[model samples]
Target: MGALLILAPFVPWGEFLSASIKNPGKYQRQKVVIDNKPEYKAAAGKVVNVNDLQTFPPNSNWVISYPSSGDSTLDAADADTFTKYELIRLPAELGGDMKDASAFVAFNKVCVHLWCSPNYNPAEGHKQYECPCHGSAYRLPDGLATAGPAAIQPPPTNAMPILILTADNDGALNIEPPVWEVNRNGVLGMGRALYQDGKVNVYKEAG
Candidate 1:
């Protein structure tokens, strides 16, 4: 079989501050075996050999390199730690409220502003999207700034993947036929990418 890869663990891009890691840190790419399958975690910058691995209970919904194997026993270039934050995707159907498919534009699941991980919280009968740090909130119906420090509205095509599904008689949700995989990371990883990669259309002057 060929290699099936799970890319880096993404955090919301901007939740953590820029000055967090000033000095260039060491990155060690580590190979992790999942269910007897070999996988890899690339380090932030360069290669390192960590003799030990460390784990911390995850406060956020996504999982990161936790209590992994090869703790201080082995090292690789994958271990160079970088603060990579990305958004999480959740699927929901049109729910009969919309009349056309064009009602939404499925973005690559990457938030343009700061790449802070996006989360879904149903509030006031509308989806309330949130970033955990600094209290940035957006209206789910439209990625408009409801109340937060965001300079401008995040485009509707960024925070979500177009979803179509139907509920079975037993209440199990089923995606009809084809399913697509996306790397919202395609455009840029986060604010870091935006700044480094020169994607300027993202943050327009909020009038």
Candidate 2:
């Protein structure tokens, strides 16, 4: 029938929607153990020191993995792709500071459109997280989708899940343990709504 053909396009979203409704807690934010030995070249795992320019330079990004299991060593290598996040240090001109959390931002690399991984393109004037699978692009610093199919999607899926960062006394960056709540820290793949002036406005689905 014509209705069935029209609804075929939305079939893919049903799985995500059903999972979100039936098991909302699965998408809730939760504390994760950062791997002491992250992949990609950083062996010390302390390579995120904000004060150390040599460790984490401005406009640079790193792919880090966090263990989903409470045990750090047990799940370090087998950590899920959703647990992996891209940490980016903004340039000084973009509010990056030596000892400020605002200077850095981290987001889950899983693309909300189809769960494909996205990579940060640091090219000048093209500093955006772009997904090769579907051409979805998320803007830096905020992780909001600006292009491709993801931009037309609704909230939560339209944005990438962000990780809250903090700077220690030594200027080493740390991830604030996330709680199981939306908009507070950030949901796993669903993401949270963006707001201005540190104010968060929660989004609710209509019945």
Candidate 3:
């Protein structure tokens, strides 16, 4: 039990963002609990019907926050305790041809260019995730920077970090805690540690 003592201070971070909370659009941290676990589960499994995803119409996004209980020092400030996920549904060509070929996809909401929340836009048949700060547009499903200054930026890792999801036998979708930084190969190792510690559980089997 002594080894488990280290897990105490490292509890799941953040509380649920209230509907009345100002700047709901702003980026912040929140606690994400596993489903039916007494605590909140962020927004995972919130979509009662996976098929209802299509009803959102194209170029729209469903934003949800999950507890990134692990340290995100490599991506954000060490004190910054949460990672937000931006959810959207697109065509098969965009979202990595998943198991069910589900068009639903999730991405780190922080824009690689200056970290503004990107919005969904579909005008003149051009669908893209557009960042408001500098007019950066990342191609949908894959979150690749196809247009905008982000494409020309020096960070070299322009694609937004993606969230990989797995569905349960009951059709509930769960987001796999990201363990690596996308496009940079830098590892977000803390995420996996938290899962193993039982401090976090993104899915039942993994918990």
Top lDDT hit: 2
Error of model 2, residue 48, in angstroms: 2.0
TM-score of 2: 0.70
Please report how far candidate 3 places residue 94 from its true position, in Å: 5.5
TM-score of each: 0.28, 0.70, 0.53
Ranking by TM-score: 2, 3, 1
lDDT of 2 by residue, 80-192 (tens): 76678877777767766556667888888777766778888888887888989768889867888899777777665577777677667776666665442345444555555
Better of 1 and 3 by lDDT: 3
In terms of lDDT, the poorest run of 10 residues in model 3 is 185-194
Q: Which stretches of candidate 3 lie over 4 Å from their true place?
A: 1-45, 53-59, 68-82, 91-101, 154-156, 183-207
Query: Each prediction's Cα lDDT score?
Result: 0.29, 0.63, 0.45
Candidate 1, residue 80: lDDT: 24
lDDT, candidate 3, residue 94?
Answer: 60
Tens-digit lDDT track of model 3 for 94-164: 64234332556666666665556776675656677887866778776556677766655433245655556
Error of 3 at 118 (Å): 0.8
Model 2 misses residue 197 by how many Å? 12
How far out, in Å, is residue 20 in model 1? 35
Candidate 1 regions off by >4 Å? Answer: 1-110, 122-127, 141-145, 149-162, 176-207
Error of 3 at 126 (Å): 2.6
